[model samples]
Target: MTTNENKSENLIGFNRLNEHVVFDSKKEMNYAVADHLKSNAAFLRDNSKNILNYLAKIASHHNGACGVLYDTIAERLSITKRTVERCMSELKQNNIIEVVKQYSKRGGRMSSVIRILPFVTEKKAPVGEDVGYPVGNESGPEHPKKPSGSKSQSPSEKDTNLSNPLLSSYKQGTVVASLLYIFDDFRNKGLSRPKFEEIVKEAIPEAINLKAYVRSVCSNYVENKSKFTNRFKKHCV
Candidate 1:
């Protein structure tokens, strides 16, 4: 009773599909799927290692199996559709996967082509690492560890010796350590107080009117160490 039109429109005929069709026989598809999965293996491990094995199984089947679909991914991982959407967004934000949308011939349905890319390397610390105190006052202590072969100087003696400003805090942490880090960062660039303000503005764009804050902090820093500030004026330049 099947007509020519029906035969032509029969996209997937479950009755006619051979048992061998269950396993993918297409070599190129298999290799492409495997390579794509491998490229994003690091992301799988870092974000959700539990989904790695399931993702691999789904990716391995490639006999016209359009890459990785959202529903299939959700089912395989036992995750909700919303959860898959969230994970996909995170992966995209982190540059783990690239989704390409294209039109399919069958009923003009839109299909997504998944391309797994290498894991992104974040340069800055994730959040709450607390590089240093954004605001502070008062003179802090000198570093506990002394330079090799040199006798450790007293707090006042250390201040006098560090007239260059670059020789301030010898270790990390504390307000002094933060200041020393900032000083050394711009030493080669020949930064002044105004230039330092520009860099601070870059870190905090909303602080465009933070000039008053900068002036107050700098004034306090100078007032607390007037003697040292005078000695280190040239170094501050």
Candidate 2:
């Protein structure tokens, strides 16, 4: 083959390889997000639709991002700039994504720095590694430790009312539905908040800390310390 022809063929081959790798990266990103939720079945249920949609969009657009602007996302999604900004804010608040200020050579406005998080799976103990202590032949790893104070409520108890209504304005039916779904997943895996929090950190790479959203149903419980404690006791066993 001619030298020029050989060079052309090599360039074509490199382009094909690059395309293949980029495609795999996108799939892996989406899968990582899904696996993060799977790891924390409880928190996943409570996530709003807006958050999920925003994530899905980011996954889809990661490949095309030389530098995308809010206007571009808003136009493509058929939503207003305010709505797009709101979703971005929520995603940032939740530690899902971070916005870095960047300038493009052809830019009018500054662009964001979009970084995808790494995938996190449970760490399995080595096949038969033994520590200084005896290894109990227990089935799986011991169940994850729960948070210190949160407990479950019985069926007959009534909910409390709150002085600060905003915090309590979380929708109960939605919260419960999300919680039930997540808790069932947690039960099957025998995991708890600390473990679940670790998984959430993996999903949201920029998130250094994790916090649950205040549920609307719990609004009444926020007024007085006594009322909050009583209501907390009533709902949770």
Best by lDDT: 1
Pairs of residues at least 3 apart in sequence or in different chains that clash in candidate 1: none
Q: Can you write out model 2's per-residue Cα lDDT over 1-237, one digit (the tens) per residue?
A: 234323432432432222212224566657755754565445332433344445455435443112335665665557788877776675454434444443333433332344333332323345664221111111233334446564432211112111123312212211232232233334333444444433443322122221133222122222344566778999998
* Whole-model lDDT, model 1: 0.40
Tens-digit lDDT track of model 1 for 205-226: 2233443444444544445566
Whole-model lDDT values for every prediction: 0.40, 0.38
Worst 10 residues of 1 by lDDT: 169-178
lDDT of 2 at 152: 32
Write down the TM-score of every candidate: 0.29, 0.31
TM-score of 2: 0.31
- Candidate 1 residue-wise lDDT at 123: 33
